[model samples]
Target chain A: MKVNKYITIYKDMVRQIESGQRKAEDVLPSENDLCDQYGTSRETVRKALNMLAQNGYIQKIKGKGSVILDREKMRFPVSGLISFKELSETLGKETRTTVHRLGLILPPSEAAKELGTEADEKVWEVVRSRRIDGEHIILDKDYFVKKHVPLLTKAICEDSIYEYLEGELGLSISYAQKEIVVEPAGEEDRKYLDLGGFSHMAVVKNRVFLEDTSLFQYTESRHRLDKFRFVDFARREK
Target chain B: MKVNKYITIYKDMVRQIESGQRKAEDVLPSENDLCDQYGTSRETVRKALNMLAQNGYIQKIKGKGSVILDREKMRFPVSGLISFKELSETLGKETRTTVHRLGLILPPSEAAKELGTEADEKVWEVVRSRRIDGEHIILDKDYFVKKHVPLLTKAICEDSIYEYLEGELGLSISYAQKEIVVEPAGEEDRKYLDLGGFSHMAVVKNRVFLEDTSLFQYTESRHRLDKFRFVDFARREK
Candidate 1:
């Protein structure tokens, strides 16, 4: 498949922004200037700028061009189903993953229903916590259907399960449905995360599917309230 | 511009889901059945179904076909910028909107910076709360630029401000940037919303813009922790 020219431009500009070469609050060059510099049409330049705005890299001011937003404080794209290893590498942060439990078991009825599993079917359960800068801010509890992921181990859970699934197993993740809400911290959250006396936590529940339209995984990620933030760029539907 | 044939199918199905005509857990007709019913091709029906899946209206299980999710329990779509009046009507509930405060005033410096307002300029501040079945569940604080909306009235505030803006003023709302976080409920939240002794609230901060690509409004919507839920459909980036 041939990639669009505008996507190439978008990736190049985003790479500059993420690598600290383009500092926050720095104003991007005018569209005319960018088109001239990149040797692309004005429409292509606008497409790249729109992608930048949609991904939360910059804010477009009316007359001032696109100004880089301060993504330094909390720069995680919760919109996509990205693994912790991929995310930490993107941010260039020292992150550690610890697997508390890894085994096959009968999933909860709710999880089973969401994962489209039968009554007797078993699924792989993985409980892990992610530590970024020495704080266990995220606790992830995941259940994968045995049909999709037949094998699981503690070592893979501690490393990257997504890598094993996508790279080694050659499975393609298509899309996911996610729900975000705030709830009182459960016992498991307190046990795994450093809550800092916070009684509430932000919970993201996800139902992941494969390219062939099969439900593969059900996950619940609990984040300490003070450490949780979700940013989204949305266009009004026509 | 011509709209795609599949989009027409998508909108019709979405209307059915929103109106409660299509009940939750109801499995939609098979692609072949839908194609025969709508006089369209299988590809067109699949496209409509895919749109439904992307917008959180349905979930497609591999063997079970597409099953409508229970959207009645929590139906407000915080994923996109939607007015309360438009949302409540879709839910078909006896919703009431009360204006707590409405006037022109000097916005806070932070809000001014986000809205790109002059230091000496004034903005319209409207504070309102939403009640569903006599339970106040939401509180909204909005600041609009005076230049964009030159007229404001208490009647319009109590009614639908979005309607007045789009219909009467012919203003076009294009997009918004939103951030969601959980914060300890303040006195205002406790007083305005029936929080039921919950200490935490979900705060959605929004910056809205018009079709001309100019920032026009800054809003903060506070919801009772138990009453808040955000659903989103996300596609993975390859």
Candidate 2:
């Protein structure tokens, strides 16, 4: 599939920003200059800049042009379907994924419904907790369809199952519908995470789909209340 | 400014969905059919459909084409910067807004910093609570730059300041950076909302910008933990 021109520009600028080629707080080239350089119209350049702004790559200051943001302050964006391993690598932090359970089991009814599987269908259930800098902050319960991911191992879960799914299996994770809510810590959450006396948890319920729009995974990530923070950049409709 | 062709198609389709011209659970026209009807390429048609999916207007099901989701089940989308009035109208519920406070005052340093206003500068501070089904579930604290909204009244606040800003003031709200966190409930939340002994609240901190990229408003929406739900549709980058 061919990418849109504005998206190409957006990705190029994001790469430059993340690579530190475009310094934080430094204003990018004006729309006119970017249009001239990219051989695109000014509107297209603006579109690219808007995408950057919406994704927290840059902030369009009033008098100043699009200026890069302090990327260090922004952690892994919860808006995307990214693995903890990839997020830790992006942040250059020492992170460890401890797989508590990994096996094929009959999924619960809710999980089956979300994954579009039958009641008796076998699915891989992986329970893992992500420790960042020696603090267990997130506990993830993931269920994947057996048809989509036939093989599962604790080692792969400890490392990155997403890497195996995308690299070895060549499966593309396309999109997801995520619901976030705050709930009282359950027994499972208390057992998995070091609660630090927090009574609530930020629960993210995710229904992940593949590129062909097949429901493949259902995950719930519960984070300690005080440690949970979600940041999003959104544009208002015209 | 000229709107993109695909965006126009996307908007039209969204209107159709919201207005019930296309019922929920109904599959939309096939890609080829849409391309033929709109005189556009398949890629452009797909682009429009992707926008619809991202905005929760439709869900692309595997082998079933695009299907309209039950909009009522999906509450206010966390992906867009929308006003309560607009959201309530979309839900078609008898939602009422009660203004608790409306005045111009010196904002706190944090609010001033977020809105990019001087500490000495007067800003409009509005406190309101949303009542849905006879229960107060949300309390909103909004601070706007006085220069942007020179005049304000409790009546307008009771109705919709966003409407007045966009319709009468001709100010186009472009985008916002929002942070969601769970915090212990405060005295203000206890007094304003019927939190029902819940110890925590889901707080949404928003910094809104105008079309010209000027920070104009800072708002904090506090919701009872049990009543809070945030939904978002996201696509992975290839």
Candidate 3:
């Protein structure tokens, strides 16, 4: 429901940057050009440009307009257990949430291990579909040990479960362990994703912990192959 | 070139596990069942089953046939500095590496920030296409600051760059800093990935560091939207 015109314009600018149409170090077509192209006011263009600068997408200098920023050495930590809402906010993009399935379910063994609970334990299975840039691309089936999060419903599922957890129940997200995979889209996945044809799925598995490093949730995020990725920064020994 | 046959069968088993057709805790359709279904030998089927058991995909009791593992509590990590080769290997899937583009080039500004090098520094830009389960899903474009890696070529790009870095050149990969983003695909990406009308790309940015935590390489892996993902585990605080 929260939409911003500037963010949309900034996104289009990024497309230009990533595609190589706007080379790194290439000064942008002035805020005036952006305003003209986006058909928005100068203030709106500045807001969008500001978001880009904060996220390291581009840089602006006084009296010189902005220069497209290079993305060479930038990295964000995946070790932090972040909710989609948290991540989307960090990325400065308009994120929309959809609840496909949310209910109490018995923990399957694999899901059980990730949750640090016994097989057959009751867990809150919250299946969330995330939309970024008006595309519903990620299907997240998150499992919370019933002890931590109790009394959930289909309506709560439609909203940010993390918000309900932190804002309503007063819980926090801390540390996490994660695994990544690239696989083919299957029948169950196809039903939800609605891909015209068979597509690959990027499967990410993780164990989420609280600030004190207490394990709280187990999440399996299925990304439409083209939309899921993980980046990192490492130091080299001399 | 080292592909595991047990894994090929395991993938099919995983497919069944995911589909409602195969319920958890229920014993698998027997190694013999698998052999008939997959048209392979009993040994091959057992090996596949063993892999499943090893990765927590299934459980095997000595006298009884293997039990289908429950997957609801699965832990998929979204955060970590993990390698594609390692991920595919862990899943026991056959991952083929394809070189789309590779060469040395000057570090772009954003890339320089990630490489922790000078903006004008030279680096090797290596682009590799990743195929798992016969699907070309990810295109990884890696930028290496010259001091860490002195040589580059299309042939080197064909094999695992990390393999060569660790084995031939001794650039041990200690850890990496990472970030993930969901965005639309650009023209440069379309050339490397056969994205057929797919609209988005998952951009994973990584800066590789050594055991000493010194930054040496920067890689931006672009996952086609349909095939991108991140998973993880977590716990809540009281």
Q: What TM-score do all the candidates reach, one by one?
A: 0.79, 0.86, 0.47
Name the weakest run of 10 consecutive residues (lDDT summed) in model 1 chain B. B69-78
- In the order shown, the candidates' DockQ scores are 0.46, 0.56, 0.20
Candidate 3 chain B has its poorest 10 consecutive residues by lDDT at B229-238
Tens digit of lDDT per residue, candidate 2, span A104-171?
Answer: 88856544466768778888888899888888889998999999898988888888888999998998
Residue A138 lDDT, candidate 2, scale 0-100: 90
For the predicted complex of model 3, DockQ is 0.20
Give lDDT tens digits, candidate 3, residues B10-35: 77777877777788768777777778
lDDT of 1: 0.82
CAPRI-style docking class of model 3 based on DockQ = incorrect
Ranked by lDDT, the better of candidates 2 and 3 is 2
Q: Which residue runs of candidate 3 sit more than 4 Å off their true CA positions?
A: A1-79, A82-238, B1-79, B91-94, B109-113, B233-238
Q: Distance (Å) between predicted and true CA of A230, model 1? A: 0.7
For all candidates in order, the CA lDDT equals: 0.82, 0.82, 0.68
Residue A153, model 3, lDDT: 75
The alpha-carbon lDDT assigned to residue B213 of candidate 3 equals 36
For model 3, what TM-score does chain A reach?
0.60
